[model samples]
Target chain A: MQTHSYTSRRELETYHFHPMVAALVPLAFLLLQAFLPKIFPRLLILDLPLVAVIFFAVARRSPIAGTITGTVIGLLQDALTHQPIGVNGIAKAIIGYAASSIGVQVDVENLTTRILMNFVLSWVQSLLLFLIFRYLLGLRDTHLVWLHELVRASLNTAVAIPVFLLLDRVKLRE
Target chain B: MESFFSRFKNQLVLIVILLVQTIALAVQVRRPVEPGHPDAESVRLLRYWASSLMTPAERISTGFGHSVRGGWSSYVGLRNVRAENEALKKQIAEMRLQQAAISEDALEGQRLQKLLDFREHYVASTIAAQVIGTSGSEQSRMLTLNKGYEDGLKTDMAVITPDGIVGKLRLVFPHSSELLLVNDPTSGAGVILESTRIRAILHGSANGRVQITNLTQDSRIKPGEKVITSGGDQVFPRGLAVGVIESIVPDPEHQPYTLITLKPAANLFQLEEVLVITGTQPNLPGDAQQQLAADAEKHAADVSAERLPSIHDGPATEADPSKPTDETAPPANNSTDLVPKPKPALHPDRYSPGTAAPAAELTPGSPRPATDAPAVEPVRKTPVAPETPKEP
Candidate 1:
């Protein structure tokens, strides 16, 4: 297998999704994120919305598109929760921008690269959430249990493997 | 300038988006949209739009799953129906005898309440709702119910299961309402220990555990004591089961208070159907029941004095009433020297007939009652003896 290094903007490959696929895929993931935990609570560790955000951001490889997608998805996720409607928005926005920028430079199609990117980005998202809640929101009671968060990041990474593969079938290379 | 903007448009867009969301978050934190408060239109609209977009799919999915599970269980999972039926029948026979004894006790309680001219609220009506979805994050333990404002669900309405109190309605939409579960870090309720009658505030922790707060370290709280709603918060009805105390340890953060862990009475995680209390009626026995009271008193007199304690006998007063008595006071443990005093009972005048005060008149600690209906009146207004002082 050969890995392509997209050092220039012209060499970078981008993917576009159909309008319906773009709208429904994240919506389905959001529904599953909110609905499935009712049956299997351990699934709470799997951040389906975050996985979807990362997938779209990396696949599209456009910082602007990724930013907007992340903002919309994160805000929707926040709206579902009782917390203030922008905590996840800020975290996912940054992650989206970063993931897409990374995608533009590196071979994100490689399985090992995708897994490592997801694992590291999950931690980044978790840290952003912690800072937003603690310092920005002034919620002193907000704390992070390292072990729980580690398991969460790992779970999201593991689930992202299958999710990325499935989402790959829907994208149209541009 | 245009060329400069084009040179780094993505960075500029990201900055603008982050700044906007940060500002929105700051505004929300500054003025949180509490239930029933209509000040924050933008935040409310954002949430409403999100709910509108998501709830239809959730309802359909939940309904389908329930239908499939119900069909399977009803048709295929009936291996021991005969043995279960016989066991239930035997249990019913035993419960009948127990019910008779409890009825007598209830009658006696009614008589005493009448003698004291005490009035209390009873659940008058409830709306059954199905849980459709959750917040999906551990930090916010909110459940979405199928019933909404259109179904007469107002914010702060107490939601309960058959087992115990679940939570209260936090946000109500046109088609669905959000339930702030008892274990959310921001949630709290007034609870009392059954054995000790010690009232304390139940708080949910970030770790999804329920714990009793505002309790002094010296309070003699032990494991396994049942916790019940104290009706002090005015959201939950009095006497509803809340939880059981699981453990008590000294609070490392607050020096004077002990961290008492609680095991919730309801299996909150596994709830499917819940009842939202819509209305409450006042229970007041009247003078026409004087004959009934006399009969109850005579029945009480027939029972051996040793078996039943007289209602007239209040706590044993010490020579110096201010000093803590060994039997009546909470024991001072090795952790602390100060014993927390019991909270005073709510003044009867607050709920007296015809007052019909607005929600603002309620104490700050109590959640405002949802409706503005007139204060309930007794069958007949008759003066009676003072209320029996409760045990400390």
Candidate 2:
């Protein structure tokens, strides 16, 4: 066996990857969400990055990876753009941790089981987001608060079934 | 130990966010043209950099939307070509008649203004890009212009058109910029009356209309008076075509000041191309504000008189109390002599051309004190009796 200098990073002979890629995965979805709408205009949907984050959280047995990724992506969004700094990072981290906690208790074998868990996750996320927007953001009588919840919940729930089944092709377990 | 680092890191993030947001709010809530504080540059830079990527994309989308709108307008124009042409011909005829009255020498004076050399006053140092898109959120209004630092555009440049003022630059980036439309409440432009030469503080009323507030009620501002900048505000050079004062309403509730309603000569919804002015010199237009009022008076007469109440310069008295306010003075006149004697005119604006008939029925100002002026006190006591006699 070759002696390794780095403990955190390793070359994979099979398909197992480091957790950072798992974190950066949502970045692709985010860029796609922002870009696709401009091109097609009508296909613009909601909660792409968040949905991806939740999916990875449940798929990855280790909750630590999702939480770390969420924090990184959140900070990246804040730095790259003009938003309240750290706000996104905090929200994403919390989301990641929550998703992973739920994931830890669930059975990974059944396809329908994953979909139901995703549906429950979407509803809980939507509700939490609405409260955060209303109180923390002070968006009273704001359409965005209700809109974020309703639109994201429905869209993620619909999108969740397909994504979970497809990712099921590759097992992500110890 | 495990929880401590995580908690501390989270706290640090919160602190940083709070610090940045406070700075942004402070920078934005300030007067234009005043060179911003040191922190403002960073905020501007941050906003520009953050929005830069989406700016071009936005501009393209906005441009496409505008093009679609323009296409729609042209389609509408084509549909109504016959009637529109007839109206245009009528307007052309009016112009021709006006031309015949004014000397060719005078017409040349207006058209010959070297000040109008758009190239010099505003060095059209354009970055040669188009508007990509526009997006507005509930928190703020913004326009995504494709030109930015790459186009040599900076923050606080004045934006206008051949028609008049539109807005000023708020946020800029490497590839895009944002514009503030004239109707935001926070948006202010210092303007001068084309008439009395008095300066009025113009504010956007959040809706399309603009409010020129805190002007003294006694200001000789009249309807249809033109308003322009007085070369004082550094943000907008003096004498740009800001807007026309459509109506001047005295705020009875405000006590001591009047709020004038300003309508921008340029319709933002109808803009295809615009001129961005860089010059700081404000030149007074030898404009015919007096003439506009005369023409508008005729237009006003054609409109039904009742609509004037809303457009009436100043807030309407909202009291509408049930209690009477001393108009109950009874006429001691012989039933045959209820006619009121004519008095001098109260206000010219209050008297319309249709006043010819009403002018006959009641004299302006004095109806010869209605003969019952002294007896009005007794009439108040016997309100029922006055009606009984009038019924007789």
TM-score of chain A of each: 0.94, 0.69
Residue-level lDDT of model 1, residues B18-110, one tens digit each, is: 999999888888894555663377777887888888899989999999999999887765877888899999999999767656657768787
Candidate 1 per-residue lDDT, tens place, A48-116, comes to: 889988999988888999999999999999989888889999999999999999989878889999999
Worst 10 residues of 2 chain B by lDDT: B369-378
Give the best candidate by TM-score: 1
lDDT of 1: 0.84
> B1-392 in candidate 2: lDDT tens per residue?
87886866544544454455444434444425454222256555655554664454555556677689899999988999999899999999998778545534333444466556532122233233343433322123234556665667777777777677777776666666666666555467878888798887887653346787778776477888888876466676666788787887777657677878877888754444555554433232324435544545554564534543333433463334695654433323334434444444444222323333444567667643333112223345654645422210
Query: Tens digit of lDDT per residue, candidate 2, span A6-37?
Result: 22211211123346656445655655444444
TM-score of 1: 0.80
**Total backbone clashes of model 2?**
16
- The regions of model 2 sitting more than 4 angstroms off are A1-174, B1-41, B62-130, B149-152, B205-209, B219-226, B237-239, B244-261, B268-272, B279-392
Q: What DockQ does each listed candidate score?
A: 0.62, 0.06
- Compared with the true structure, all predictions reach lDDT values of 0.84, 0.56
**Candidate 1 residue-pair clash tally:** 0
Q: Quote the B-chain TM-score, candidate 1.
A: 0.71
